[model samples]
Target chain A: MNNHVILDVQNLKKYFQVGKNLTLKAVDDVSFQLHEGETLGLVGESGCGKTTCGRTCLGLYSRTDGKVLYKGQDVHLMKGAEKFAFKKEAQMIFQDPYASLNPRMTVSDIVAEGIDIHKLAANKKERDEKIFHYLNLVGLNKEHANRFVHEFSGGQRQRIGIARALAVEPKFMVLDEPISALDVSIQAQIVNLLIKLQKEMGLTYLFVAHDLSMVKHISDRVAVMYLGSMVEITTSEELYENPLHPYTKALLSAIPIPDPDVELQREQTRIKLEGDVPSPINPAPGCRFKGRCKYAKAICSEQTPQLKDMGNGHCVACHLYNQ
Target chain B: MSKLLEVKNLRVSYHTYAGEVQSVRGVTFDVEEGEAIAIVGESGCGKSVTAKSIMGLIKTPPGEIKAGSEILYRGENILNYDKKQMSHYRGGESAIIFQDALAALNPTMTVGKQIVENLMMHRKTIMVDGKEVKLTKRLAMQEAVKMLKMVGIPNAEQRAKQYPHEYSGGMRQRAMIAIAFACQPKLLIADEPTTALDVTIQAQIMDLIKDLQKQLNTSVILITHDLGVVANVAKRIVVMYSGNIVERGNARDIFYHPKHPYTCALLEAVPRLDLKNKQELASIEGTPPDLLAPPKGCPFSTRCKYCMEICCEQAPAATDFGDGHEAACWLHHPLAPKDDVPFKTEVRHE
Candidate 1:
């Protein structure tokens, strides 16, 4: 219960009952803490439950079990007003800007929606001011406020999404692959804008993405997830420099280097994972990665490994590292 | 080295209500037999247009091939070919794999039927023992299964019966690849095939493309914005900006020692795993200029960090920068007067 800890999730579990008795463990036993004014990057491949985890954390989807502690308070146990206050404190930025924003609503209405719901604005003028303020913060001009979502470009729409998230004056935001839908040239602009806003507003973020390079660039600490579990978590530099988990290593190796000379000269020993990822419904006993892991042993299939700290705040979950 | 496909000064424009939007301007490049070439640029940079032009897929009326456009496939002018001739060239000589697998594929038809259709249409008719025999449906189905297996789609026989919607995004892309490779075309044009896929799936598709190209000995034209995706895949790189080929060279030369200012900016703009600390990513300010009235000088001059006065007034001719590396910029022009101004230090990222 540290004040520095803006949001802390303990053993979060979200399971969907597929059949009469079977359950699909979308997010099982996932734990992480987002500190004040810091970005925690959650990265994994598609269907790895990163999106589910983010949505569940935002209270959009209720967690089947476990606790989401916000500023030392249990969010699940909070009553009407308390939950409403928590909603104001934490906001989410969705992946697709075009779909996330209502097409019928103008930029002003879209951004001011949160403000209207929370009644944060004193009057119409104040609501307009707040909308423009957040818009300017995200690098959008006043003229863009009147335009609809369809009129703006992808990057601009994402900015409006960010502005909508910030309209509530949230201390922490869940950025779920915000830049993935944007162009490469515009990605840098958005990232920089996020950094500037974080610095100015003292905002904390849970930045989820599949792009390892961009995640490493923006995040203070990084967590690697695979098949509904946190496989590794460490400082951004440490995670990229010395990845401990086998899955993490494979994922990093698969990233194509931009420099062709370095790409060619570098021995690309791709750890070709055999077969597709196993289904989440009734997952096999022991390690989830045992099927694809090259170094997996009999012990790996028999017992699941817990995330253990290697050193210097680097935590990895693997039987190979346990020895 | 024989050139498999050569495009010279390709100019494609779309007739819009506002004006004629010139999509591609004087794009020239060559793909050697069995070599992979990449056209790298941002959206609206004419990379896709260049690929569409090569495939003769550019829709006319709105899109018209202006003068000074030449597309040579195996030393023959494909532009001059009629629709029937182009159809023969399409699935038989060269194939294109588009970005959206779901959109490109026929959702109602089973993957097997789709592949079989291409095979039946393109597979050369043969005679056995002085007796002509048409290809049977069974033979086409067998070839379709073979194509699926070649692209590494497991349980090909069963999966082939399933429609495109049943297949995952990666599998659909693989199926698209199967269709493209059914006839074993000499040249393959993959226009951002991995853009819609996840990184892992993207890697898989890229690997499949590379492996197939090697096995078939087919040249590839990879058009994409992701620099990393094209890093090891392409032998040569052509950097495009505002409908013009700004720089062209071997992949190694372009990545290691980029000559054009736009190329250098693009390389620096991309976030890399190797870069430590949040150094300012070099972003080219402003969007690409409108192609209808493209600037007289370098197309990138408006946003160029090293823009000179001469660059704004007159177009910089293509200048060779050793070892087949060339760039179109006033800085490289010998006759242009040198400026004392240094490159702009506008830090893009924090």
Candidate 2:
């Protein structure tokens, strides 16, 4: 990976107001950086703020606080032409392929929507050519150009979503659970296609997914999230091999290996986390994961810990790691 | 262990706008008492149809279980059973838990009442104070709460009194499991039980299922696409592709010494959590064939890398590898080249 920082998020926070005096802190005090051609995976369970954080970084959701900088320019502060340029430079692939693509629009029209917006093509023939080019790049044939989005299967629809994002020629992409909806046999195909495309296009990616194995497979670095807080961030290998935080350890251990022999061996050493994730709305003052954390202490509910670097660029936010 | 359930030559088809969709085509398997078996495959592979057929949940007019299909439950052919016998067979002898607990459960009834009604229908007596007594409404309510607590749900009393929507995803699933096991049925078919749950929760549920199977000594047929989950809970696995049994073996046999191309490709396809280094995933080349006018040969032949000329024309019969392990593939034929089978020489067997 290059030393150039493509995207930098600083102390980002996004909140939603539900009741008269209640505030839902969806993405609270989360920060990370994406290097050129590097894929940073944001992983957490469902209802965690990983999706919200990705959206805030892409300027899809306006941040309630902090700044999201793209190439040294603030994404949320961009104006008319600058905003348009940022949109062209950054694209998002949604989680659900079935719901994301418009049913009425043909595959060619869905893909060319971005190309036409950026005025990448001059004539109708050029537009058609650009459309088919992206479709082919994602493993679809030109014959699929005229077909409706509903006609294709889940994997094909995801490919179309990828093609739509790539048609914009974006330097940065935020893939939000792009392969979660696809089947087991089909997820690898999409993951491989994404890796191949990143290599060919030199694109930086912010891959947000709940599937930890795939996240580790596709990411250079990974950030683990709790309710609304980032519990750990480190190189993918280090995070998987030597997780520090209690929540991170539990999360990693919870993923069942495909091998029966390994699963048999791991059963004894697995960390069984107690209770469910607590409510994120008006969450307690202490650590967000203290309710489910096995190693939580008295001070854990009083003061929230910030991310601290241990070594080798590994950061853990917990009282146990604090000392 | 005796055979608790046996499905022989199971054939199911659905009527669509175009033609009949041959869903479960000649699937055959048996589950021994107290044993947990898994039916694994991708979408449109008829794993769910097989599960539904076992539960007698298939609609007859649009969907039909063809003649000669037999789902024998303890020497009794359930296919010939009328409505009264079918209802008696369901829940009393066998029960199924669905993927979406929210949808499967009744919206109007309290969780406790649903369990109570299920218990009242299937069972008449409860073990109280080490004595068998007629089940009263109050006793059934307490039994329902007991079942809820057994499935690891906390505050069982209050949670049981609440509606289905009031409970969380994991809790609702726990409640569903409670109801399924309330009757202490001999057979339990969990259709993708944890597919909608998160990873950590999925592991928890799988563990709970394993524990319950041991406690109740109930036979289980787990239907899911997740191979990792299959590894954890299933003793034996039956792999399906396009409504056909592609491979069947013990968990170790399928994972360590897979012979079928589809099975090998599937194992290579998943990005395992045990991965030490970055590696490109090996994927099957094409999508599964359409089942409307299903192919005559191996359905996986269209995408199999080792597909031979014979594979396209004829379906290969099951080749046994001893110890209840078998795979349907032409490459396993004695005349076929032996060296070309990549998964044939895995290190674990030696």
Instruction: Identify the candidate with maximal lDDT.
Output: 2
User: Quick one: best TM-score, which candidate?
Assistant: 2
Off by over 4 Å in 1: A1-3, A18-22, A123-125, B125-134, B291-297, B335-350
Query: For model 2, which pairs clash?
Result: none
Question: Per-residue lDDT of B73-159 in model 2, one digit per residue for the tens?
Answer: 998899888999999899998999999999999999999999999999988899999999999999999999999999998988898
Error of 1 at A247 (Å): 0.3
The DockQ values of the predictions, listed in order, are 0.62, 0.79
Kept native contacts, as fractions per model, are 0.61, 0.70
Candidate 1 has an fnat equal to 0.61
Model 2 clash count equals: 0
> What TM-score would chain A of each candidate receive against the reference chain A?
0.96, 0.99
Candidate 1, residue A157: lDDT = 89
Roughly what TM-score does model 2 have, to 2 decimal places?
Answer: 0.98
Put down candidate 1 lDDT per residue, B31-63, tens digits, no spaces.
999999999998988999888889889888899
